[model samples]
Target: MSGILETQQLTHIFPNGKAAIQEINLSIKGGEFVIIAGPNGSGKTVLIRHFNGLFLPTKGKVLLEGEPITKDLTEARKKIGLIFQNSDSQIVGQTVADDVAFGPENLNLSRKEVDHRVKESLEAVGLSDLANQQPHTLSGGQKKKLTVAGVLAMNPQIIVFDEPFTGLDYPGVLQVLKQIVGLHKNGHTIILVTHELEKTLAHAGRLIIMEKGRIVRDGEPSQLINEVELYGIRRPYGQNRSVETMTWLS
Candidate 1:
């Protein structure tokens, strides 16, 4: 089968003449869990943003399936859900349930269908009971989960997370991690862009690393993550790795 997402000689250069990513050729298979890691400004975000058509390439093209992403940016955006790094920016509705229903309602889904999706999405994120609460009143972790629920309500085929675990304590990370694993098991393609590795390595099959606007390495997470710090990422020391292993296995 053709890859669900592909970038052909993908290159992006800013107006000021700084290159974000250069010649990035990549293919993402359906249902695969991929980790895109790099030091700050290694082009991880620049590359993935092309997948969903948020940032079109300056020189090359991003393809969804065999077709160029530029062909149908609307459909591509619907298929690829990007959960931004700042969870707060994702929240739009005043109430929790209202927020979760935003995407489905925008799709022109019937009221019953929209309600059903809102219920299911909230339940999936373990926030069903908080449906009637004010979204602004939720804690940081709950807000993140709410952000994910909003995306889940859209029912996208591919989910790309940008710095998903940047903020949050241990339990918060575990909560989000569990949701990500569950989504993958249910057959959603998962692409994660994060600098921290130790807690997430066990959950991913392939690792792609970027440095200086170019791909430095792409391989198994265990092999690539251990050596990624040379570029700028630290693999989360002072925390026991065994716990993360258990998180994935459980």
Candidate 2:
């Protein structure tokens, strides 16, 4: 079956002549929750960046609905909203509402439409009350939610989150995790990248493990959960708990 988004033999080499990712063929169907996990330097970030044309492939190509993403980078990005690991980096406006409106505003949307999107997106992430607050004043978790809101405002069919839980307290993790699961439940295809599988493994339908710039394993999360430790991602299970119980929400 063709994927809503796909990468064929995707490879990327940095200017230093090092291949960050190599021969990564991936297919992501609509409404699927996929987790890409690996230790640091495993090319997880590089791979997702290509999904929306953030970084062009050194080899192969990225397809959105079977058409090259390069053919219309703008449209591809609108369909594939990426929430970066560092939320602060994605922030731009002085206020939370303004920040979320940035993407829609760039699309030349009418003021009413932009306001509508910003309002809906902020509410989706539970940040409606903080719309007038300065972004820099938000907590780590709130900042993450703000980024998600920013992406959500773009009305992307797919959302890619890169190391979303990097630095967050227990409450922060729970907040972000709930938002992610809610997005999936609401019919958004989710592509999440993180080595901390214990926080979200149970929620994912598929798990893809990467090593040395290539995918080493891809299958059902339960089937691959035991093998993640082999690729340097800490196994989220033990004798007492199973993959189904490996979520921060519980």
What would you estimate as the lDDT of candidate 2? 0.93
Per-model CA lDDT versus the true structure = 0.86, 0.93
* True-structure Cα RMSD, model 1: 2.3
TM-score of each: 0.93, 0.98
Which stretches of candidate 1 lie above 4 Å from their native place? 236-250
lDDT of 1 at 47: 86
**169-191: candidate 1 lDDT, tens digit per residue:** 87788888888889999999999
Off by over 4 Å in 2: none
